[model samples]
Target chain A: MSPKDLEDRLVLAIKRAETQLPDDVVSALEKAHEIEEGSAKVQIEAILLNIKVSRETGAPMCQDTGIQTFFIEAGADFPYLGKLENIITDAVKRASSEVPLRPNTVNPFTGKNPGNNVGRYVPYITWDIVKGEECTIHLMPKGGGSENMCALNMMSPGRGIKGLKRIVVDHIVSCEGKPCPPTVVGVGVGGGADLSLKLGKRSLLRDVGIRHPEPHIAELEEELLELINESGVGPMGVGGKTTALDVHIEYAHRHPASFPIGIAVQCWADRRATVKITKDGRVEVI
Target chain B: MATVKLNTPFDKKDIQNLKVGDTVYITGKMFTARDECHLKMLELHKEGKDIPFKPGDMALFHCGPVVQKKDGEWRIVSAGPTTSIRMEIFEDEFLKTFETRMIIGKGGMADRTLAALEEVGAVYVHYTGGAGALAAKAIKKVTDVYWLDELGVPEAAWILDVEEFGPLTVTMDAHGNSLYVDLRKEIEKNLEKIHAKIENS
Candidate 1:
């Protein structure tokens, strides 16, 4: 395929991600709106309305457009292997200036320069090699409110199942309204620090109300959801019955001595969009 | 008159008179500053340079907006409020120096901010955080901008003429009652009941 064709596909893909709200995120917001009651109900209604206005008006759902991170699945035979990285970086810079996305990136140590993609591991592009002729990209704009609530705990293996539940639920309860509930609770279990954290964030990509394929993990998801909602963290941390819209868990093998669990909470605005590029250079935005 | 008239050190009686859902059309010169701008404003005040726009009788919005230039001027694209808790640390001293009476932001702050509001005769208004474009439309004109060269658009405060600018909700009144504090307490109580069940189970 010609480089022009490839660049055109890339640009369209970025714009499509910007303009469209992903089905999963929209459905999650709708479900969150339906289940909420009382003042929480009002909050959700307003939130939904705000989202509608944002969509119709072509403004970002939140002022903090957040760090533009991409998770990519690419085929080994992908036409533009070396160029995709620069294409993605260029897309981010263009989006930051054009989409008028907030320049959220700030330097850590110096406390100066707004490089515009400056979080710890920001504009984070996670890549996976797949056996296919197509390249797919998932765009997730992770905001600061929910990102602030992310944490990890070193639990004893002896504490086992019950201890794990307590740690997850307790942290959600403590955060209350700060993370901007109702939230999707992503729990990472049995991995080392970095892996566990990735697992936690990866869990958020799951569809709302969808349970894990594994019965055991699914059960844990349910129990945690029930426990978290019971906390009354409610919509925007107001008084109500439902604090969490859903709970997702992902796990990995770890050292026998270590039981590292990471929690990444996402706010009600959970914005995500995806796009696929064909070998022929046609772009499909999902 | 080109300017809107407002007074400083607003009293409880004045605050009580103000409703939660009141439309405010502000004209008197107000500073547009958020996190970084506020820090610089403080430094300017410390050095005894004439601070931009007197804080008394002026409004400050906790916003970092999307701005663009047209015909040799900058304009707001989406200038909605940001979460105010991040500013909770600087509010006490800032309010005193700025002598502010109205703070517009989303969500709410802690008791300390409420106390500071009471002392400063200021009220906290909750703007819809995500409705940036809608909010930006209300601002009629960009009169001036401060700290533009060094700090970039998000940090610099843009002075503007705002008309019917707000249907802002008052989350904290000057008398010291805060909706967020009460709401959080209620949520905590309900949380305990849920934990009790989990423990018993």
Candidate 2:
């Protein structure tokens, strides 16, 4: 209800996201570890061990604690909407020092770090409004290595879904080990260039293995996942059976002439956490 | 398949003996160097100025760590490898100029780095990506730090002492062998088939 209460809850949510892998992601990785062999198996084992150490010590899972990003779904009637931005920013500052997030934000021109993880438009927030009495916040701390692998393609509308599949497959293959496979591939189709990329990144917020409601879109996700894994860019790209843990696709209606495809890749760590807050000040973090 | 244990100030023979896929654990001293640290080190080399530490005596890690100062000591909270390919442009000269024998990072480096490894009798090992906690556990102490003010924490060169610090896999070797190169070729071949499957479907 109050700004301090909300900020404190956000800080704890960030700490959870940093130190613990979500249940879905952890289970998917466990499955990969069981199925892989040879060098790929070894890499997965190290990753599992790392996950254990991170959870136990409450240390960040990755050194690149990532640029802080929050996806907020707020009820139009939620009383604290006006103060949400400031509260979220303050939470980031506290989490940067307390959870000890890497100071990832830097001035593009001056190359100076304020060292608090707050800078021009950082702790980037994406907001959605709906009719409800609760605000739900999702934190996805995206690492730099995989973030660098994001790609966008503008294709002729005539190219169709086949062309989309080709472009996505080609991009992931070219990325090789750079994005840190076993990665989660998020593909955004049909939107304008910027919207496509945004949708692609937002699609990563979905839990691994959950399919889209539409049958056709769900099928596309399965096909893309199969093709990517078949590429043999396995765990950390050393070669294995599982190149990607999952593939997620989100789409929007396109203009007559242009089809833009955006690819957002997330590494194996795939750190994300969700918090739900009610108008009465009750908070729950997952 | 074999596991090798290496200490700092590695002998050329120890580096030369490694091949792709061999797991390695390292001990002794190392320095964290990321984009700015690499650039600054190269610039210092060009100016013929003294470097803060001896490159040949320590392993170079491509890392930007989360650190905290507690009780008057710098502590590594999470220290994992950054993607190595970003440093591809500087690595060849870095290896030749400093004769650094080992590189620890995630992802992989390019041909120039592989060639430099062959020429310099060095190897590039991969610490698992996102395994920062595991890495910090192996680091025994922060010996010193350089360029803290100029480059900030992640970009600063933090000198560290570590013990048996790795499940690092030798991905690039002094004999001009690279596991990444091999994987890329295989993936490319598979991509063609995947494209065909997409076309037919």
Candidate 3:
């Protein structure tokens, strides 16, 4: 397909990711509503209504259209191997204006907003090269509230999994109603600082209620979900039974001396979309 | 437990009457100021320069809304509350200097902020985080904006006309009660039980 075709498809993908709350997240939120009362219930009701209105009107789900984050898996033989980056950048530019995405990127020191959502390395992309002929691109419009709650800790290997739990829970406990409770918690264990955080963020793309393939990791995720919800942080941190709807864990092999843990999160809006481009140039949203 | 519809420029009594957990809907004149504007406001005051608007008894929001221009006019695309804790350091001084009566933000603020709210007879209202579209429906228009060039669009102080603009919960009240502070303590007391269960699982 032409570069413009790819750009247009990416624009639609961004708009969809920005406006539509995924089905699994909505379902999980509905369950939280059933189990909550008072301010918690009220907040959930507003969230549900907000999702409905955003979907119907095609407005953004959150004001913080967030930093556009893309995860791409391209087959080594894909035709646009070298051009994918430029194509995605063009897509982000059009989406920034057409989806009318909130330009959240600003210079860290100067605080200058380029206003186009394209800054040096802004619409950050992560790549994984595989052996297929097709490519899959996933976009997540991550809001700032939950993103602000992300934390990192370097621990003594002696601290073990127990020490790991302490830091992660302590972080979320302080978060309370701040990170938009009933959140989807993402935990990355073992990788160094940056890689751990990356794993934590990427793990959030998994569907709600899904677990790791490994039993131990799945068990850890299940336990944290219950424990976080037990904190009484409830909805909007006002006070209720559920603080988090789910927890996801992703891990990597680590040095015997190093154990770095990372925590990230997504609010109930949990907006993300995926698209597939065929070798024949057909761009289809999956 | 009660619901109140407040018009801005509200006095001490209007704020003090509120208790933690009471829901409020604000109407009338309000202003927007976030990270940059707060710091700038403080700096300007320190330099003996006057602020752009009357903050006394006014409403302030911790938001950076998404706005666009069409026909040479500003339009709101998405406007949602940002986390409030980042502003905690400047909040006490801001509340005292501005004499602000109401704050609408997402996260519950810290002790410093809660204490300042008590002294200034103000309240910290918690709205649903990321519910930008719902909040947008209540915002009728942007009446005026300031500091666009310097602070950029998101960080600029946007004077907005909002009508019945909340189901905002009073997490921190002028009566010296804070839902956040109290709840956190209770959670800490219960943490031992949690630790025992999750210990090495």
Candidate 4:
């Protein structure tokens, strides 16, 4: 496939992710709207209206527009293995202007903005190689308010499952409305600090309604979901029945001495989109 | 549940009249400033140099907006309220320096900001978070922008002309009362009780 075509395709995908709340996110908001009352309900109305206007106008769902991050799954023998990074970066820079994304990337020490949203280590990409001829890319625009609530806990091996529950609940309690509830929480267990946080954020990429496939993990997700909602932090943290829309967990092997848990969070917008490219050079955005 | 309209450069009477949970629709001038802008303002204050714009009855919004330049003119595409807690340390000094009467942001602020509200006769309004488009709808014009080169788009101080911009709730009032503090206390108290019950069970 030509570089321009791939770059244009990625740009389109980023714009979609920025403006539209996927069906699953919208459906969840609808359900929450129906059951919510008082100030919580009022907040939801504003959110729903914001979504409607943003979608219709192709404006961003939120002002932050978040830092753009991509997860790529490329076939082991995929062509253009070397060019994928440049293609994504070029598309991101284009999107920053064409889609008018808020140029959020900054030089941490110097506080410099390149203005095109591309900087050192920006448009962060996570990659995986698989046995296939097609490459898939997922774009998630994560707002900073929610991202700041992310936490990693390295507990003694003795804490076990019960300790995990305690830490997760405490984290939510402390977060309160700061992260913009009803958030979708992603919990990663057992990995080292960085991996755990990455896994936690990766969990947010899952389909909204899907729980962990394992029985034990799924049960924990369900229980954590209920417990978070019951905290009464509600919509936008004012107070409501939906403090959290869902909780997902992903794990990796860890050192026997450390029981690390990471919590990654997404605000109600939870904007994301996926695009798949075939070796035949066709690009399909899902 | 009460609805009220306020113009910029609020009088003491206007600010003192508000209470927690009061719905406020603000019009006239409200400037957008965030962490970086606040720091710059404070630096100017230290240097004893006059900052741009008029003060008094002024309201500042904690936001970093998605702004684009078209034909050399800036337009606001999104301007949602950002979390205010991050600015708690700087807010008191800012309120004092800018003579700001109100602060509009997403999450509520901490003790320092609440104290600033009490001392400075200002209020903190919690604009519904994530309603960037609706907020942009109320903006009549991007009157001016400053520090674009220094702080970038989101952090730059974008002076705006907004009208009837609202769905803002007065979570902190000038009368030494804060709904956020009260609610947080209640939640923490409830949490302890729940924890105790769990332990007993």
Best by lDDT: 2
- What TM-score is obtained by chain A of candidate 1? 0.91
On lDDT, the stronger of 1 and 2 is 2
Write candidate 1's Cα lDDT for A108-150 as tens digits: 7786655455356666889999987888888777878789999
lDDT of 4 by residue, B1-201 (tens): 577898886888888999887888988998888899999989988999988877554689999888877899889999899988889888898887777899999878888888888888899988888889889988889988888878777788889889999888888889888777777776777667656544543
Which residue pairs does candidate 1 place in steric collision?
A105-A118, B32-B157
Docking class of 2: high
Model 3's TM-score against the true structure? 0.94
Could you tell me how far off, in angstroms, the CA of residue B137 lies in candidate 3 after the best superposition?
1.0
Model 2 clash pairs?
none
- CAPRI accuracy category, model 4: medium
Interface quality of candidate 2 as DockQ:
0.84
lDDT of 4: 0.86
Ranking by lDDT: 2, 3, 4, 1
Q: What's the lDDT of the predicted structure labeled candidate 1?
A: 0.73
Highest TM-score among the candidates is held by which one? Answer: 2
Residue-level lDDT for A210 in candidate 4:
94
- The second chain of candidate 1 has a TM-score of 0.85
Q: Candidate 2 on B39-126: residue-level lDDT in tens?
A: 9999998999999799889999999899999999999999988888889998999999999999999888989999999999999999
